[model samples]
Target: MATPLIEICVEGIDGFLAAQEAGADRVELCASLVEGGLTPSLATVRAAVKAARIPVHVIVRPRGGDFLYSEAEFATMLEDIRILRGEGVAGVVIGCLTPDGLIDEARTKALVQAARPMAVTCHRAFDMTADAGEALEALVRAGVDRVLTSGQRDTALEGLAILKRIADQAAGRITVMGCGALDADSIRTVRDAAGLRELHFAALRTVPSGMAFRNPHVGMGGTGKDREYELTLTDTEAVRATIAAAKS
Candidate 1:
């Protein structure tokens, strides 16, 4: 048996380079981690693609509020995908939904069509849909290459059962990449339980806040936490452990 391949999500240029150095098979590039994740700027995407030794997949999210997109937002996403495709991204990650939490087939199909040469990944918005089973079929029908999900749970660990079922149901018709709260310690469990051979994680470790002083006067009463940025580097130890576990 072989170790599962890892896809690391990088929030910036540094993380992208780090992931490559740490031995990631691929990198998913995005911005605005605080709002979960938003599509990165063209400059950032281009820089990562140029710096990375591995494939770089750009996230095509226009905003962070919901998977449902307005006409304007959809247009923006389409344009972003076009620009990213031109910039030489290996793939594009995106998801769209209807107000009722079903796959917005029309919108998703359009995006997939626009992302022609580059592969398309349906992002975690799959967890937001009413039916994971139905959504999987919809995505397959729409011609998506893969899906990034946490098993429809808050984290992949909790979603392993469903992820396993999804993997079985998909039957290689589409790829399911388990993401969210994935680290070295739990990667093996997720892969074995989900019966998958590919895994995704940001491998993010918290960075020290540069702020030296606390602001006590602001209504939010707490230690003024220094901002934490997701390091672009992959955690070599975590990756090695995950690989070892997967092989075992």
Candidate 2:
């Protein structure tokens, strides 16, 4: 079998360069990984594109929480796609679902049409759908290039059965890229077992802040965790290890 394409979900230019350096086949560039990846700024997108040797796919999510978007938010997504297309990105990852958990084909098709030659990937919002098979068909009809999913489960490993079924159901009409909680050790099993040719993971490791002065009074995120003094980055060795394992 051929080596699986490894896409590292990265936060900024730092993470993007790290993934590329570590031999990632591609990268999904975003702003707030803690917020599950929002649309990166045009500056960030330009820097990554200028520095990238591997393909860079920008995530066009306007906000976090649910995949449902208001009309205004949908408009924001379209404009972002237009800017990213001009920036020469390899693709865009987007998702817009109806209130009842079905693909918003109208909005999705519009985004796809806007994306043009650049590929369009339906993000994990596919997992939030009521039915995996039905959602896959909806994406195909919408002319999406691929989908990122975990079989509606929290992690790809846990969702192996449905992931495999989705791969089989795709039947060459669409590409099924398995993601969620995958890593170097488990990637091989997930790839071979789920019958996936592409895989996604963060490979993030927390590094303590470099600040000399420690302010122990206030935390930034308001979640009550002291992550203010820490940074999450894609570990180069971790990416290489995952690629090696998936290929071996």
Candidate 3:
């Protein structure tokens, strides 16, 4: 039963070519997903890594609330992870904390050793940790390769029992991704009760902005939710029916 990987949280390059033509398997790449995601313009990560074929995990997040950062926003997140590791892009979704929450581990192990060999996720800020099994063992001692939780509750099937106790305390040493508000009927119940191999979502919807002219008043994301003409992409058949309901 091994088929669950399906990551998909896009925002640019047309939601990363509509989540890689609706097959997704990876494609976080972000930028102002309504302030929940930021950082996304090394020319839209080199045009989604030259219109990638899969794997495109970008998201250095310079802003959008808090994960605590200051020294010049952690040196602009280490020069945006050395310019998205020289645009070879394949990973980088970081997190940093410590205004007394934990897991700052020297700026998260110096942004996971400057994101070498790419592959380094830790979004959802690990659900704003206060201690999810000590921030999943401080993101497996700061070498994090994955994590995009919802087990902090608010979705992911209301934190499917803390994502099955952080996937049984990450028995596989890290890679539990069961995101919030997952769709296609809740992604096979949070990937079979959180034994999840990996799965994040964003099969968005909300279209309506081929404006020909209409200014009823005003509202440019000043938190009034007028959403300039509205448009939240990523819905290639709802990412092909949530990857065919996580492979049936």
Top-TM-score structure, candidate number: 2
What is candidate 2's lDDT per residue for 107-222, written digit by digit as tens?
Answer: 99999999999999999999999998999999999999899998789988899999999999999899999998988788888898888999998889999888888777767766
Poorest stretch of ten by lDDT in candidate 3: 218-227
Tens digit per residue, CA lDDT, model 3, 73-172: 8899889998889889988998888987777878888888988989898898878888888998988998897888998888989889988998898999
TM-score of 2: 0.97
Worst 10 residues of 2 by lDDT: 217-226
Deviation in Å, model 2, residue 99 alpha carbon: 0.9
Query: What RMSD does each model have against the real structure?
Result: 3.0, 1.1, 16.2
Q: Weakest 10 consecutive residues, lDDT, candidate 1?
A: 222-231
Error of 2 at 18 (Å): 0.4
Q: How should the candidates be ordered by TM-score, best one leading?
A: 2, 1, 3
Residue 105 miss distance in model 3 (angstroms)? 4.1
Evaluation by lDDT, superior candidate among 1 and 3: 3
lDDT of 2: 0.92
Give the number of colliding residue pairs in candidate 1. 2
**Where does model 1 exceed 4 Å of error?**
211-240
